[model samples]
Each structure stands twice: as structure tokens, then as C-alpha cells.
Target: MIAALLQGCGRGETPVHVSQFDAFGIRIDMQLLGAPEQLATEVAEQTAQDFALTSYSLGLEQPGPMQRVNELLATTEPFAAPPALLPLLEQTRDLSERSGYLFNPAVGMLTDLWRPDPVTGKCSEPPDDESIARLVEAAPTLDDISLNGIELLSDNPAVKLDFGAVIRAYAADIAVANMRARGIRGAMIRIGSDLRLMGDRTGQPWRVPVLRGSGGAVLGTLDLRGDMSVVTVGRFQSPCFRNGKEYSRIIDPRTGYPAQGTQVVTVLNSGDAVTAAAAATALFAAGPQQWGQIARQMGISAALLIDDTGHIHLSPAMERHLQIIDRNAQVSVSPAWQDSGPQ
Candidate 1:
């Protein structure tokens, strides 16, 4: 999940404050335009602290609220939900249902099986078929977990909680909200490949380059206006290989295997970072044939998917915003998503 941010030219000599920090296992880049230097620095520092705290609380491997929740879930017993983590769990549960279970966080057991080495960021080998089959048979889902008030319990012990798919984006949304509350309107918050934009960049629309592959050439650029979220999901790093075939890190919960048939999926949502990020992952899992259906279900109008065969598929809304840079690229457009209700 990577997109290049093209900085806008300065106008009227308004100060542009930039800050970079490491959080959630990735680098976070933030920029505030047309704000007083002291205020921008204060907001950036505060947001950085918030990001650090959120990452620590939700960390999967560390001793934190999420880790404690997983422990209690494995016991299949009722326990008090961590106050800080409950809201995120509730939000993702709703997103999972909206995506028709395509963006499930309940597949943590499945994800753990395919977890990459911390240093290499690649799995040495795929999980054994038997192990995958056993978990798939259990069919753990968010539905198996019951949340009532502050209490929670899982009917199936196999259900584990992992928020890696949407945590960065979710945190970015929080940071943005905080910034807005502080009266800072012009800003950009990037957590990993998930980006949140507010207002314009020095009175110019934010220009983002959508890359074809990780460290690969740009496919095109998106000119985003006002507040928006742009997120891309893919196995940007080298995937695990066996028998000369590559395996993606994005797993399909139903099959207990890495999703195939699509190399990358990018989604744009207005003022909703979590949905944008989660929808991209879900669309990737849906692959080429069903991505359109899932995108419509998630209420995502702007999306672009590049299949493994190097064909470009774009939703009608995306085609309008994206300026194609690869002239010879084969492109196909999907019909516009018809929304049934407010998203």
C-alpha cells in the first residue's frame, strides 16, 4: 500500500510545517499548510503522541489491550472489553458485515498462520494444508464474538483479533479529527500507505501518484480536493514463493489462503480513512471478477484494481479522477456503483 505525495508549490509565503515519525511499524508523514509554526508543531507533536499510544494499545505482538483481549477470547469466556479497544472492534465488525465478510478481523488465526518474519517481511513457507483446513472448518468470524455493553465473549475459541489491516488508517482518522478540532484545516496525514487530506494544499488540490507496484513506476496521479481518504492495499513487498508461484500476504478468510488474481487495489473515500483502507483490502480479496460487487456493497465509488495479468480495471468514478500515465496500458471500466442507502 504505497502512493507518492507530490508537494504543492508555496503560495503567499504561508509557512508549511512538515514532520516525520515512526509509528505502527511504519513511517508516518504529516504536513500542515498555512498554519502558524508554533501551532503546527504543537498539533504534530500531540498527534504523534496519540499515534504512538494507539499503536501500543492495539499492538498484536506486544503486551497490550489487544493482546489481553485475544487471550480472553481464546478461553471462550466472558470478559470485560478494554474501553480503549471496544470502539474499534465495534466499527470493524460493522465493516466486516458491510463487505459481506470480505474484510473480517476475526481471521486473526488465519493471519497468524501466514504472518511474515519481522525482519524479512516474508513468510518462509506457506502454512500446512491441514492447519489451514482445520481453522477454516471452525469458521471463526466476528459473528462468533458477542459484544454487550462493556463485556465480550467468543463462542469459538479459534476466533482471534487482529487489526493490522485497518489500524493505521483508523489512527489517521483520529489524528485528523483531532487536528480539525484544533482549528487546523489544511493538513495531510499519512500512515503507511493510507492518507487523509483536509482542505487544499496551499490552495491547490492534493496530487497523489498511484504506483503500479511497490517501488514501481506510477500508473497515474489523483487530484484530490477537500477532505478525503486514499488507500491502497497489496502485497507490495516480495511475497512468499513455492513451486515458482507467488503468494500474497492479504489472505482470503473463506479459503484460508492468500488472495490471488489481483496485484493491487486502491480506493478513495471522502472523510473516511477506515472504510477506504478496509475497502481496498476487501476489494483485493474479492479479486477481479467480484471486486465491483464488493466495491458497490462497501459504497466505494472510486476504486482501481490491477489484475495479475497487468490489466487495469477502474470504477467509473475512478476513471474521472485518475490521469493515466501509462499510455499503452490496457484499461476497462466498470459501471458506476448504485448506492442503496447512505454509506
Candidate 2:
């Protein structure tokens, strides 16, 4: 169990108290603002338990329906139709087709191979290239897995659905929904580094500091006062080896490899943490070129991209929300940045 406590005054009322806990590796931080002490305690305890059950994959001891489907895709021979796996299967299939197979064979295969080891807490590497090549040759198409709520199997079943790219975002969305249902406003939910913000902090923007180092020093800050969901993805907070090899926990579903290049990317969505989370991870994996196209396609409100060179690129929408505070050196937004327009 990992835990941290935050205490600060808000609205000149009693100090706001927030306690974050990670049980079974489902990260959650609960903030009590202007609430009764007893009620806050109860809410925190209950919320923690709820998040642990629904969001923590490791906590799901027995294979739930989802896990069962995942297992089926892993082991059993291909069937005609798998009813339980329909939703995920359909989503995977659609994404595969739309992404022009850029996301299909690679992503799922890699996830299956390098998923974090439960005991070691480290991600394993993919099988040899020859093995991957053979698997790719025998990969199943999206159409192959689309069964219309029925069970189906194929003789060549090399492909599988690895929703690791989207699961954290999904969990964030679930947490936001649950919080809203309970009438909790003016709060932020952070699962690992993914986050969702609801309401304002006493009419002021909620300032979330982005840390570049693992020690949590401020790299920058985002002002999320409105009802927006913000998700950040990067290699910053992940573990690093002394040999100069940095491995991000985020895996690119396409090639079964850890996402590389660029330091960080933050995606802001108006109301969907899940979408924001997915976009952040996907954009990071896709890199800047693909990310720009996606930003235009998705109409993302704002974005911040930091690369290995320490160059910062801010989307047009992000300028309004940025206030740089580099006391030691001059850090300027790039001229090519859309934000640096005529004004």
C-alpha cells in the first residue's frame, strides 16, 4: 500500500485534506474540500475500496468476464464467436482496420509479451524477431475477431486484443463518473499519472504541477479550473536503468515495444478522461508528426510536447493556459508553435 497526504487551505475554509493511496497498484487520490470530517473519511475509505476493485487489474484475483476473454484469446483454439469478448473485440477490430493495421498485429503481440511482471514489477521484453515475424505472418485480422456477439475461432490465430493502451484511460473515465454520481465537485482524480479535473478550486484554476524528474520537482504546471480531463504521458516518471536505457511502462500496442522518443505529451479533453488518457499514450507512441494530425482530427483543445532535445512545443490552445516560470534560464515557446501567432 502506497500513500501520500496533501493539506492546503481552499476558499478560506478549513484546510483541504487529500490522501492518495495505491493498493494493488491502482493509484487513487481523494481530496476532501469543504466536507464534514467524518463524511470525508468514509468517502475516502469507500472510494479507495471501489477503485481498488474496478481499476486495479492485479486485484482481480479470479478472471472476471474481461479477463476470461483475454485468457481465451491467449490460449484456446479460435472459436466461431466469443460473446463475452464482443465489445473489446469489436473495438480492437475497428481500431485495427481504421489504423490500417498499424495498430493491430504489433500492439497486441507486444503487450502479450512484455506486460509488467507481477512479481518483479518490471516489464519483460518481446520474443526474438524471428518469432515475432512468424506471429505477424499468421496474425488474425480485425474481421477475424469480429463475431457479432458469438464465439468464433480461426486456424491462424496469432493476433489478440491487448487493451493496455486504453485501459488506464477507461479507468480514469470510470473514476470521474463515480465521483460525479456522488456529487463531488472541485476535485481531481489521478490514476498513476493520468488525471481528470472537475469544477474549479474556489473559482480559481486548479494548478497541477507537471514533474519532469521522478523526485516530483516541477517541470511545469497546468491550470485545469474548468470541467476538463487532462492526461499526461511521458518517459519521465518511469524507471530508468543506470546503463542509459530508459523503459517506459507505456507499450506501443503495434510493435510490442516501449514507446520511444520525446519526453512527454499532455492531452486535454473537455469531458472524457478515458479519451484523454488514450490520446496521450497513443500520441506519445505515435510521436509528433502523427500527433499533429491526430490533434487536428480529434479537435483536441490543447497539447504540450517536450522532446529529447528539451525543445517544447505547445499547441495553439495551450498558450492561453501556460505561464512559464523558469527563474534560472530563459525558456521560450517555439516560433513554429501555433501559439506564437501574430499576437
Evaluated at residue 33, the lDDT of candidate 1 is 80
Show model 1 residue runs off by greater than 4 Å: 1-11, 119-122, 335-343
Judged by TM-score, which candidate is best?
1
TM-score of candidate 1 relative to the true fold: 0.92
Residue-level error in angstroms, candidate 2, position 13: 2.6
lDDT (Cα, 0-100) at 321 in candidate 2: 71
C-alpha lDDT of all candidate models, in order: 0.83, 0.58
Candidate 1 lDDT, 1-343, residue by residue in tens:
2222323335657677888888876788888887776778788888888888888888785677888889899999999988878888888888899898889899898988888787666566778999999998998888999988999999999899888888888888888899989999898887666689999877789998886854277889999878899998876744677668778879898899999888889899987798998899899999888888888878788899988888888887888889999887788885434332333
TM-scores of the candidates are: 0.92, 0.74
Tens-digit lDDT string for candidate 2 (208-264):
765452325456677777568777777765543433677766655455556676678
